[model samples]
Target: MARKVGIYTRISRDDEGESLGVARQREDCERLADLRNWQAVKVYEDNDVSAFKRNVRREEFELMLTDLRAGLIDGIVAYDLDRLARKPQDLERLIEIYDDRPRLEFATVTNDVNLGTADGRTMARVMVAFANKSSHDTSRRLKRKHLELAQQGKASGGPAPYGWQKGDPEKVDQEAARHIKEAQKELLAGVRIGTIRTRWQEQGLGNPREGTKRMAHHRVTHILTNPRLVGYRTYHGEILYGEDGSPVMGDWETINTVEEWEAVCAVVAERQKSQPGRSLARTYLLSGIARCGLCKSKIRGQTNHKWQPGSKGARYKYQCSKVNGGCGKVARVGEPVDELIAQLALEEQRDRAASADVSPERRWPREQELNDLNTDIAQLIEAEKNKSISVSTLLQVLPEKERQRDELKLDRARFYKEQKQAEAKDDAVDLSLEEFFDLPIERQREIVLHSLSAVFIHPSGRGKRVFDPDLIEPVWRE
Candidate 1:
C-alpha cells in the first residue's frame, strides 16, 4: 500500500499569476509523491497569500491540515523547502506538528531535503530567518514610500478627511468640497460643536463604517483643532517638522484663510481663559450645546447670588467668556433666557419637521436578475475562450453587460438613499406652535435653553437681565 501524501503550495502576492512557476511547482510535488510511492491525497494551494502571517485564513490550506490531523495523510510533499513556509514562526508550527506525529514525514523536491533529521531542521531555521528579514525590509520600504507621498501632498491609503478629496494634483470631489465648506461655515456661525455633530448626523454625512448617523462632538472638535484645515501638516503629535532637514512651518494644506484661522484660535483661547477655575459641580441642561454667537466661545454659568445664609433662591446667568476679548456683553439669567430659547428651538424643530418631504421609493432589480446577469457574463467569457464567439463580438457585447451592471448598482444606491430620507421624515419630532406660545415663562425658558445654541445678552451696569438674541443675531444668522 502506498503512503497518502498531502501536497502543499503557496505563493506570496509578489509572485502571483506566474502560471509557468505554479505549473512547475505542481509537477515537482507530484513527482516527489510518486518517487516515495505515495498516493497524492489532496493539493493545497494558496495563491497571492502571505505565509509570513500567522493563522493562515486560506481555505485550501486549512482543509489540508484537517485531513492531516485526521490521519488521512501519512506524509507531505512540496516543490521546494521555501514552499512550506518563509516565516520562522510558521516554520516552527510546522516542525511542532511533525514532531508530535510520528507517522508523518516531510519531503521537498528541488532541495532534496528531509525534515526528519537535526541537520535538515537547522537548515530550515536559517532559511526561515532570512525570509522573515526580507519580509520586514519590504514592509519598511513601503512605509518610507508612504511618508514620502504624504510629504508631497498625495493620497496615501485611507479616505480623505472632511476638508479634502481623493485625487492627484487637482481634481477635487465636488460633494466633499461642499461638505467642507458647510462645516467651516457652521463653525464660523457660532454653532456649538455638539450641535454641529447632531446636524451632520441629521444630514447623513461622515464615514459610514463609523456606525454613526451624525457627527460626534469629538470629531467636530478634531476638525476645528486640525492644522490641516488651515493648510499645514501635523505629524507624529507635533505641528512643526523638518522640511528639507531643518525646522520649518508645519505641513498644513490650508483650507481656511489666515484671518479665519486666527479668529478661530482666538475664540478657543478666550473660552479657555474664561472657564479657568470653574468647578464641574455646576451642571447646566445644555452646557455642551451652548455657544457665544460673537466669538463662538462657550457661555459659562456664573452664580448671581450664593445660596448661603444671606441669600436663598438666588439666580445664575450664562455669559460669554468673550475670550476673543469679550463681546463686551453681559449674560442672561437662567429663567428668562432659557425659556425663550427653548420655545424658539422647539418652533424651529416643528417647522423643519413640517417642511420635510417623505421621499418616494425607487425601483430596483431583484436578486435573481443580478445573479442571472453574472451567470451570463461568466458564460460569455467561457464562450470567448473556446472560440465559439469572436473576441471582437464579445468585446462589443461586454460594454452592454457592464452598462447594465453599473445601472443596477446606481439604482440600488438610490433606493437606499430614498429609504433613508423617508425614515428621517418619519423620525422628526413634532411640537405644536400654539403649545410653545402658551407654555409658562419658566417652562418656555427651559425649552429655549434646550433648543437654542446660545442666547447673548448685551452688557449692562446692572447684573443679570432677560436674554436677547438681537445683540448677536449678526454672528448666528451669518
Candidate 2:
C-alpha cells in the first residue's frame, strides 16, 4: 500500500492580484510527494498567514495537525522546513507528535529527516533553530523600520482608529466622528458605558479589533480615553513624549483640545477612586443618596408585606437603615418620594432648556483660547528642543495655561451634555431602564441624584399615620 501523505502550503502575505507563492509551494510539495510514490490524501493551504506570529491563527495548519494525529495521514510534506514552522516550541510539538506515532514520516522539498533516529531529531532541531533565528532577525528589522517612521512623524502600520483614516489621520470619517462625539456626550449625561455600547451595537458600529458590530464596555472606555482623539500620537497605550518631554502632535484634525482630553481623564479617574465598585449595574435608584434627617444616617430601601399590621400586599419604602437600632426616622413608601424628586428635576430641566442658548460668539472664543494655549505649549517644547530654554522654564510656563484649558474643557463637556439631554426625547418608561416601576431606573436615578443632593426622611411621631410628603426634606445639588 502507498504511504498516505498530507501536503501543506503557506504564504505569510498575499501578493497583490495573485497568490503565486503558495501555488509554487504546492507545486514543489506535490512534485516531492510524486517522486516518493506517496498517495497525497489531503492538501492544506493557509494563505496570508505568518508562521512566525504566535498569536495569528492558521486554521488549515491546525486542521492538518489534527488529521495527522488521528491516523488519517501517515506522512507530512511541505516546500521547506521553515514552511512547516518558524518557532522552536512549534517544532518541538511536531517532534512530539512524530514520536507518538513512530511510523509517521516527515519530508520537505529541500530536505528529509528521519524522526525515528536521535541524530536525525537533533539535525531537525538545528534546522528549526536556524529558521527561528531568521524569524527573530526579520522582527528586529521591522521594529527598526517602525522606529524610523515614528522619528519621521509618520503613522506606524495597522488599521487607523475609528474616526481617522490610515496613513492620513488628517481626514476624518464623518459618520464615525459623529458617533465618537455623541458617545462622549452620552457618557457625560450619566448613561453607563455598557448602555452606550449596546446602543452603538444596535446602530451597527463595528469594533476595530474584532471587526464585530457589538463591543465591550472596556472597548468603549478605551475610545473615550484615547489621546489620539485630540490629535496626539500614541504608542503602546501612552501618548508619545518628545525628547523635550512634551506630547508629540499627530497630523490630524483634533476632535478635542488637550485640556478637554485631560479633564475627561480626571473625571474618570476620580469616579474610579470614589466608587471603587460602583457600576452602571447599580440595583437601586436611591441606594446611597437618601438619608435619615433625624440621625444623619443613610435611608435604605426595603419591602414588607405586613408593615401596618393589616396590609395584605408587599410595600416598598425608603426607610432608615438603623430602624431597629434606635433610629425611628423613615419614609413609609418609595413611590411618592421618587415621584416628588422626579417632578422637581423635570421642572428644573425645563427651566434650563427654556433659558439657555449657547451662541457661536459664546462658544468659539473659548475654543480659540484653548487652541492658542496648545500652540504656546508646542512653541515652549520646540524652544526646549532647540536649547533656548531649560526644562524647568518650560514646565513653569505651561502648568497654569494647562490648568485653565482643562477647566474650560470640563465646563464645555458639562454644558454640552446638559444641552443634549434637554434636546433629547425623554423615554424613561420603556424596558430600556430594565428595573423600577413606571420609569427607567437609570433616568430616574440620574435626575434624583443630580437635582437633589440629598433626600432626607424625618420620622412622623410614632403612631399609625399616613405617609406624608411634607416629612421629606429635599436638598438641591446646586
Candidate 3:
C-alpha cells in the first residue's frame, strides 16, 4: 500500500506580506511525494512564521505531530530538513516521534533521509544545527548593519514618525510639525497630555503607528519625548552618539532645536516623576482658577441635589469648602460667574491681539549666552575633527558645557511659554466669550487659567435675590 504523507512547508518571513516562499515549498514537496508515489493526504503550512526563533511555536507543525500520533499519516514530506526545524532540540522531538512509530516515514525533497534508523536522525540533527548557526549569523549581521546606520544618523527603515512623511524621512509634514510644535509649547505651559490629545483628535490628527484617526495620550508623550524631534538618530530608544560625545544628528528636518527638545524633555520628566500616573480630566470650568475672596482659597464646582418629590431642583454652583483648605463661607451660582469670567477673558484676548507688539519681547542677554554656547560647541567639534582635541578630552569637556547650556534653555523655554500664555493673542478655543458654554469645560478651564491668575468669588449680602457680576473679581496676569 502507498504511504499517506503530510506535506509541511514554512518560511521565516514574508517580506511583502505574501506567502510566496511557502507556495514554492509546497509545490516542491508535492512533486517529491508524487515521485515517491505516496498519497499527499494533508498539507500543513506555517507561512511567514519562523521555526528557528526561540519560543516561536509553529501551530501547523504541532498539529501535524498530533495527526501523526493519531495514525492519520504514515509519512511526512517537506521541501527541506531546515524547513521542518533549525534547532537540534526540535529535531530530537521529531526523532522521538519516529522512535515511537518506528515504521513511520519522514523525507525531504532536498535531502534523502530515512527517519526509521538512528543514523538518519543524527544526520538531521547535524543539518538543523547548521541551519541554526546560519540564522544566528544573519541576525548578528543585521544588528551590526542597523548599528552602523544609527551611528551615521540614518533611519533604519520603517514608517516615518509623526512629523515626517513616510518613505521620505527628511521631508517634514508642515501641518503635523505645526501641531507638534504647538503641543510642545502647550505642555511646557502646564497643559496636560490628555488635553493635548483631545485637541489633536478634535483637529483630525491620527497616530500613524496605530493606523487610526484617533490620537492617544501615550502617542503624544512618545512624540514629545522622541529624539527625532530634535534631529538626532536613535536605535532601540537610545540616541546614537559619536566618539566626540556629540549626538548623531539625522538627515531629517528637526521640529525642535536641541535646546528646545531638551527643555521640553526635562519638564516632561519632572511632571512624570511628580505625578507618576494619569490625572483625572478637569470637569469644572474654573475649579483651580477661581478663588474664594474670603479666605483666598481656590474654588471648586459643587452640585446640590434636592430630594423633594416632583421637584427639579438640582443646583450646580461654585463653592469654597473647608475640606480643601478653603473658608466654607463663600458660594455663588455657577452660570453667571462662568458667563462673566468668560466675557472678561474674551476681552483680554481681543486686547492682546490689538496690542502693538506682534511677538513677545525676548531676553537677548540669555539668548546671546545660548548662541555663545553653540559657538563654543561648534569650535570644540571642529577641534575634534582636526584632531587637535582628543576624543577622550572632547568627551570630558563637551558634556559639562552642554549641561550648562541645557539648564539655560530650560529656563528660557519656561519664559517663552509663560509669555505666550499671558499674551494669548490667537483664538485657541475658536469660540467667542459668550460661546464659552459651547466648548468643553476642560477647554474653557484652560482659557480661564491662561487668561487670569485668579477669579475671586467674594461674599454677597445674605438672602441674595439676584446674581451680581461685580462680586466676582478677576485678577488678570501681567
Higher-scoring candidate on lDDT, 1 or 2: 2
Please, what are the lDDT tens digits per residue for candidate 3 over residues 100-167? Answer: 99889888988887888978877877788889999999989989999988998887775577798755
In terms of TM-score, which candidate is stronger, 1 or 2?
2
lDDT of 1 by residue, 383-473 (tens): 8888999999899997798678667644554454444333332322554556554533333334444335454444444646434556433
Worst 10 residues of 3 by lDDT: 421-430
Clashes of each: 19, 0, 0
Residue-wise C-alpha lDDT for candidate 2, range 1-478, written one tens digit per residue: 9999999999887634266898999988888888889988899988778999878988888898899899999989998888888888877878888889988977888877766667878988899899889989988998888766665556776656777754465677777878887766555546666776777787766344334555876777878778877877776677776764456777667676654455455556656778777775555567677788788787767776466656644367777765445275455577667666666666666565568674542243376776776777778878988999999997998798778867866666655444445433232222222232443355467656655788777787878867677887888867
Whole-model Cα lDDT of every candidate shown, in order: 0.59, 0.71, 0.79
Best by lDDT: 3
- Cα deviation in Å at residue 100, candidate 3? 11
The TM-score obtained by model 1 is 0.37
Candidates in descending TM-score order: 3, 2, 1
Q: CA shift at 143, candidate 3, in angstroms?
A: 2.8
In TM-score terms, which candidate is top? Answer: 3
Kindly report which residue stretches of model 3 are placed more than 4 angstroms away from their true locations once superposed. 1-128, 198-205, 208-217, 243-246, 256-263, 278-280, 292-297, 303-316, 322-333, 352-356, 359-431, 434-443, 458-466
